[model samples]
Target: MDTMRERFASVTSRLLDEDPRLAVVLADIGVDGFAAAARRHPDRVVNVGIREQLLIGVGGGLALTGLRPIMHTFASFLVERPFEQVKLDFGHQGVGGVLVSAGASYDWPSGGFTHMAPGDVALLDTLDDWTVHVPGHPDEAEALLRHAAAAGDDRVYVRLSVQTNSAPRAVDGARFSRLREGRRGVVVAVGPLLDNVLAATEGMDVTVLYATTVRPFDGAALRAATGLADAADVVLVEPYLAGTSTRFANDALADRPHRVLGLGVGRRELRRYGQLDEHLAAHGLDPRGLRERIAGFLTSAARA
Candidate 1:
């Protein structure tokens, strides 16, 4: 199976060949992957080396010159490290660009906390007009990237992670698409968590909704699906930090008193370096762990 990173390189190369206005800016990451693209379009594909700050600055400059800049790097460096650049260079300057991030959350646990960015989306939420796309698989990633590139500088953030669902669904980024129908509760699977969420809710009387886009939150779609039932149990299974969407969920269900569960990576650092599955187990993000927590939560909701 192709990874999100692989799809990204392929799409970016195609964009470079198709759109003369498209320029790719890299901060010493994924440079070798696009060597052919860089060779073909010398003026379009640029590697700025380890300076993420300048990496963003160059993108901002390219945007000013009427070029659509696609910036790539690790999530930590792309979003957190050069946040000021992101804020001012793109936001303050009124220039739009696509910011694609790899090593989502703790995808690079071997690299430790410095390379991780669990709070990237939370940080982006503080800004305006940023479309966050969290695709669950390589196909979804490719589709979302194409959407962003065609969107024309609407301040897009494409988050890529090592975790992936078994396959891609016919996901439309406009709203949350309901995958399963039930009555007891609703489970919103954001990005890569679809597989885990489906496994957790198997044989249960709960609805499942899949989302490739999270920033818009799709409150209207959520309300329509759940009917805004009072005290309805709604669980949000995200790949990033737990409770990140608690506020959004509260806002969506503000009309009624509902029980919400936000399951994902814990806020505290795991500290130990290991494989991705080890980290998932440590955070209780595996299928079994998610099923246990979700099942228990549903039981309690029913009792209440």
Candidate 2:
């Protein structure tokens, strides 16, 4: 069971061999993993020596030449640090490329808050038409990565995390998979939080929806699950910033009278450089914390 980042390096190495149009740009972040790939395709695999902005600029330049570029880095450096480059290089320039990231929200707690990026997705939401994939398992990550690499002129962002579920679900790179059905409410679990969400909602009469590709946000599936009921109650459990997808959910059920509770990393930064599990628990993302919040939200909604 290799981590998603390991799988990314291996799978992407093979992709470089398979697709001549594919190019990978790195900022010295995953250089060791991609060392062999660089040797094999020196012309295509590029390392920008810790320059995050240049990493994105190079990808955009490659995309301008009609090559599908895959940019790799930690989440904070990839999205937050070079956000202006991301906005202008790809979005404003109107080109397509795949941005693959590691070091999710609190993946490396010892790296400290500087490495964490719980607001990455929310930040990207400001842009338009970007395909975002948050894979919960390595297999899903590979599948989504392949899809993004071959997307051919469409802007895609694939967020890779250290956290993963016990198993992988079949991901089509789009649409929400309904894992459990209930009439009381719907709990939408986004990447890596499925196992905890499943545990939290155990035996509860609430629909559980698993989301791997969240940007295009399968609003249709959400509508179908809740049946657009007047008293619909929805809970979104994401690994990134809390309420990141609340607006999307609201737009999805705009016509209906419904309630949505967004759950994920809070605004307050935890200064303690604790373990990953400790971070999850502190943010109320562990099974115990999630159960309390989810149950309370549903119970209160029932009374309403």
Candidate 3:
């Protein structure tokens, strides 16, 4: 499968060539992927080695100067480390830019917790007027990147995860697209967790909703799906922090009382690190773990 980072570099290169307004700022991560783009558009592709704060500040400056800047780096550094820069440089300045981050929650487990950022989305939620896109596949990443670049002064954040699905699906809007129909409940899968979510709910009687753009939480589509399916149980499976979207879901379903199970990376730090699979299993994000959790939740809901 084509990785999301590669697709980001390729699409960004095209954006640089075609749109003079688009610029990319890098922080020594995935710089090689954009080497050719940097060489061609030297002035547009700016690389500030190891300085996450400067990286975002430069992007904000570029945006202020009537140019669309795209910032790239690991999630940990991109959001968590330079949070003040994000809040002040971009948010305070009222300059919109696209901040694209690679490496999902625990994509680099060998690098330990310092390299992992499960609270990125939650942190972004603190700010206003920012659009977040979590694409499940490379194709979706390319599409979202292009859309965000052309959005005209919209502050967008595109999170690219290392894990991907087998193939790409159409993502034209922020609404949830129904993948499977069931009567028991609805399981909304976010980003790269789609395949695992499918496996976990394979034999279960539940409606599966896929979401690539999670931030603007498509309450209308979710409400319509749940209303049509008459499901009061909702299980939001995200790739980031657990219960990250629980509040949004609650607001979406405020018209009716419902049960929700939010699943994702846990808050506790797992000091032990080896492979990505190990970290995923430890967090109950693997296929088997997800299946067990989903089944237990639904079974308990049934009894209730």
After aligning candidate 1 to the native by TM-score, how far in Å is the CA of 191 from where it should be?
Answer: 0.9
Off by over 4 Å in 3: none
Where model 2 places Cα greater than 4 Å from the true spot, the runs are 228-230
RMSD vs true structure, all candidates: 1.3, 1.0, 1.1
Candidate of highest TM-score: 2
Per-model CA lDDT versus the true structure: 0.89, 0.94, 0.90
Q: Which candidate is the best by lDDT?
A: 2
Instruction: Give the alpha carbon lDDT tens digit for every residue of 7-43 in model 2.
Output: 9999999999999999999998899998999999999
> Across residues 27-70, which tens digit of lDDT does each residue of candidate 1 receive?
88999889999999999999999999999999999999999999
Error of 1 at 49 (Å): 0.4
For model 1, the stretches where C-alpha displacement exceeds 4 angstroms are: 228-231
Instruction: Put down candidate 3 lDDT per residue, 45-154, tens digits, no spaces.
Output: 99999999999999999999999999999999999999999999989999899999987798988888888999999999999988999999999999899889998998
Whose TM-score is higher: candidate 1's or candidate 2's? 2
